[model samples]
Target: MYLGLDLGTSGLKAVLIDDDQQLLGEAMSALTVQRPHSGWSEQNPADWLVAAEEVMAALGVAHDLGAVQGIGLSGQMHGATLLDAAGDVLRPCMLWNDTRSHAEAAAMDADPKWRAISGNIVFPGFTAPKVEWVREHEPEIWSRIDKVLLPKDYLRYWLTGEAVSEMSDAAGTSWLDTGERDWSDALLAASGLSHEAMPRLVEGSHVSGHLRDDLAKRWGLKKGVIIAGGAGDNAAAAVGMGVVTPGQAFLSLGTSGVLFAASGAYQPDAPSAVHTFCHALPDTWHQMGVILACTDALNWYAQLVHSDAVTLTQGLGPLQAPSETLFLPYLGGERTPYNDAAARGAFLGLGHATNSSAGARAVLEGVSYAFADCHDALSSTGTQIGSLVAVGGGSKSAYWLELLATVLDMPIHVPEAGDFGGAFGAARLAQMAVTGGGASLATPPRTERTIAPRTDLQAAFAEGHARYKRSYHALKEAL
Candidate 1:
């Protein structure tokens, strides 16, 4: 057996997988996301460790630790976890969703040398800007920062007594050379940071260290159990869904939505529309387009109307076509195709008869349209994506899946596994590390369901997609 751990924003998720890739047990422990002010997001480092330890104990109750071989760590990407000389957390981790360093990001992007070396534009959500944010706003805290770690690496340090990061996570920091796959001294100097302040880099599946005896006892694992270096959450999810091969893609709808595809060589889009990152697969690369507020809009609507899923979705029939009402779907600003962080979501062409069900359906359609835009961007840059596999919280919604099919005018398939994305990828990596073999990661065994494009909806989405493209243009001045 092997264990996989995901240190997510709101919780620590762990899964136990046997040698055959079958799941034995799973556990989760929830944490908090502190928002002291607007546009700020933070989480306690110790909270993740506590949650991981609890989940491990709960999972151990069902599966014996004696069979466990290796462990893998995965977590939210681009979150900067600052640490001091004694390995104590200097402050709450600055998360990826937080947009507090726009000035720093813009300044970094202004330099032609950055794009020449890193092959990507700077973003406030990335690590280097967060470093700069701390350096300027919180000088006292910045002075105490002896080292910086991403979210997953912070948890792995507690488990294995080592502070190391995998390339996939490091690639999101805006300080690594995407082509050469290491820290770029020029970029680091530009950001006013030192190379020694960053953690050591390793491949995603490389074994970083063994479980310390005290932590092993606390988590009911054998002393010296190997821990593999894990990738960022999305990369790990792509691997778990078997989207690690070129031309294959995965769609995730959680707090955000993303369309991701693996690549053999580094491919960065001009103007930095899509983000290029190292894949969880060794020596492979991938690109992603993120929808800032995918299901999050739905969540907000649920709160506003005071209705549950059962109540809201009761009378909704299959959408015959895209509605005339179009949604911008940018409650939290956009990344790909439009790099504006201040962009806000909107609903255009709403009429008097638009009900709660119509609002829900439009939200789904808007996200799909955004994905179609992403597809266009990829095509312009020469990525050959054939199929898209849906995962995360939205994969269970048949209605949303059907909408994606109509919007993309292609079939959408779901993996047999439900929502254990990054955790499952971590387990698979652990299995590979334990066996020391180059086994191919299994594709999502078979399609749970396939949704084909609805002919009637084609024209409506085409018009709506055109207007969707224009919505960003109209909102640009306001942003």
Candidate 2:
């Protein structure tokens, strides 16, 4: 048996699988994000540990964890978790969605070396800027920092008592030489850091360390079970969905929206705000266009109307033409194409005729248009996405998927229902770590059905999308 632990923004999940890669059992524990100040998002590292232990205990209650031979971890990328030499957390981790470091990010982005070396824009949520933010605002905490680890690496340290990170996660830190797949001394120096303050690097599929004896005994696992260097969430999702080959793509509609495509080469289009990061596997890379909000916007509106996303989306009828009402799903700024941390969300074209349903539909369309922008950004990089497999909480809504299909003018595949997410992908990595297998083991799941673009609504959506694009530029100054 093998174990995969995914420490997500909202929860920590544990999945158990056998040598054949079939999931035997799984458990999850919830976590919460604390936004003490505007534009900032954080979580206690202790909370992550608590959630991890909760899931493991729950899984142990029902499964034979003693047979577990390997463990893998996956988590949200770009979170800055600081540690002292004694291995104590210095403060709450600054998460990927936090935009508190916009000024720092802008300053770093101005330095061409950052883009040249990292192959990414210095977005506020990236780890480097977050570290810089602490340096400028919380110098006392910064002074004692001995190491900076991404979210998952912190969890890995708890499990194995080691500070380790992999290519996929490190690529987001703006301190990595993406093409070379190693830390860049100049970039680290620019951030007032060095190699000594960073975790040791490894490939996602390789074994990084072994589980600690005390924890292993408590969790009913072998003391020295190998732990794989797992991936960032999206890269892990790609592994779970078998999107390792060049041109294979997946669209994620979680808290954020992402259009991710695997690439065989290190193609950087930093100016376009398309993220070029190493894939979970060695000698591979992926490019992604990101929008800061997706289901988050939906949930925002749901809260306004005192309804849930499922009910709100379910209340709507058949997919209709683009609503006269429009929304910009920039609830927490944006990433791809614009990289505007100060940009705010707005609901345009609202009139007396606009009701709750129309507002909800507008929210959905706005998100679709945001994705259309992402698609265009990727297209500009000459990255062709033949089709996209839909994943995340928002993908559960058929109406939203149909509308997204119409807006993108491309087919969207929905995989058979199961836990083909970060945790499952991490399990696959664990399997690879133990068995010495590679891409061949990462097979795509069976497609349950496909949602094809509505040819009938093609021209209408084109016009709607054009208007949507125009609204952003026209309202940029005011919004």
Candidate 3:
């Protein structure tokens, strides 16, 4: 048996899989994000360790803990977990969604050397910008910083007593020369950090350390259980969904929306605000276009009107092709195609006739349009993605999946595994680390069904997509 742990923004998830790749059991522990300031997002690293330990205990109750051979980790990316010299957390981790570092990111982007060295722009959500923000705004905390760890690595440290990071997660930090798959001194210096402050880098599948005896005993597992250098949540999900080969991709509609495309070599589109990063596997790379919000946009709107997102959107069934109501799903600003952190969501073309159902439908269509824009940015890298395997919370909604399919004009497939997104992928990575190869597990993902594009909605959606693109610029100018 092997275990995959996902330290997500909202929770911690654990999945247990046997040597044959069958999932034995899975569990999750909820976490809360702290928003002391308007645009700042923070989480307690201690809370992550507690949640991780708790979930592993729960999962061990059903699975043969004695048989657990290895562990792999996946997590929300770009979070900066500052630690002191004695390895104590200095402050709450600045998460990937935090937009507090917009000024820092813009200042870094102004330097031509950054894009050339990192193969990507340093966005507000990335670790390097967050570091600069801390240096500038919280100098006291900066002075105590001895190490910079991404969220998953912090959890990994508790499990294995080693501070190490994998390539895929490190790629998002802006301190890495993504094309070279290693830390860039020039980039680190730009962020006012150094190589000594970063964790040692390893390939995602490589063994970074062994489970400490105390931790193993507490979890009812044997000592010497290897801990593999794991991946960022999206990269692990790609591995889980078998989107590894070039031209393969997946669209994730979780808290944020991600359009991920696999690339055989380094292919970057930093100028377009597309993320170019190392893949979970060695000698591989990926290009990602991100939307700061996806289903979360629906959740936000639903809450505004005192309804749940699923009931509000899914209840409307299949919305008509391009209703006049168009929304910009930038409630938390956008990443791909536009790196604007100040962008806000807006409902354009709404009139007296606009009701709750129309509002819900508009939200879904707006997100799909955002995905379409992201697709254009990713495709510009010359990777022709024929179809996308859909995952994340939105995959459960047939209406939303259809909307996405029609908007992308490509088939969207939902796997049989249901909502187990990053956790399942982490487990697959664990299996690979223990047994050399685990490709059989994800080759097909037990696809539940495929949603093909609605040719009938083609023209209407094309017009809506055009308007969706225009809405952002219009709103930006207005704001």
Measured by lDDT, the strongest candidate is: 2
lDDT of 3 by residue, 287-394 (tens): 899998887898889899999987886578665778788888877667988888888788899899999989899988989998998889877767689668888888
Q: By TM-score, who's the top model here? A: 2
- Taking all chains together, each candidate's TM-score versus the true structure is 0.96, 0.98, 0.97
Those runs of model 3 whose alpha carbons end farther than 4 Å from true positions after fitting are 418-420, 437-442
- Please count the clashing residue pairs in each candidate, in the order shown: 0, 0, 0
Where model 2 places Cα greater than 4 Å from the true spot, the runs are none
Q: Tens digit of lDDT per residue, candidate 1, span 1-479?
A: 88889887768899888777778889999988887876688998888877977897898788788778899888899999999989999988988877788788888888887777777778778888898999999999999988889999988887776788988899889988888888999988886678888888888877888888987786677777988887889988876777787898888887777888888888887474788888876779998887667776677666767876545544467765767677788776677788777777888778998878787777778888888888777777789888888887776777777778787777888767544588888888877776775645855647767778788878887888888887779767665
Quote the RMSD, in angstroms, for model 3.
1.4
- List CA RMSD, all candidates: 1.7, 1.0, 1.4
* Native-to-model Cα distance after best TM-score fit, residue 148 in candidate 2, in Å: 0.3
lDDT score, candidate 1? 0.81
Residue 363 error for model 3, in Å? 0.7
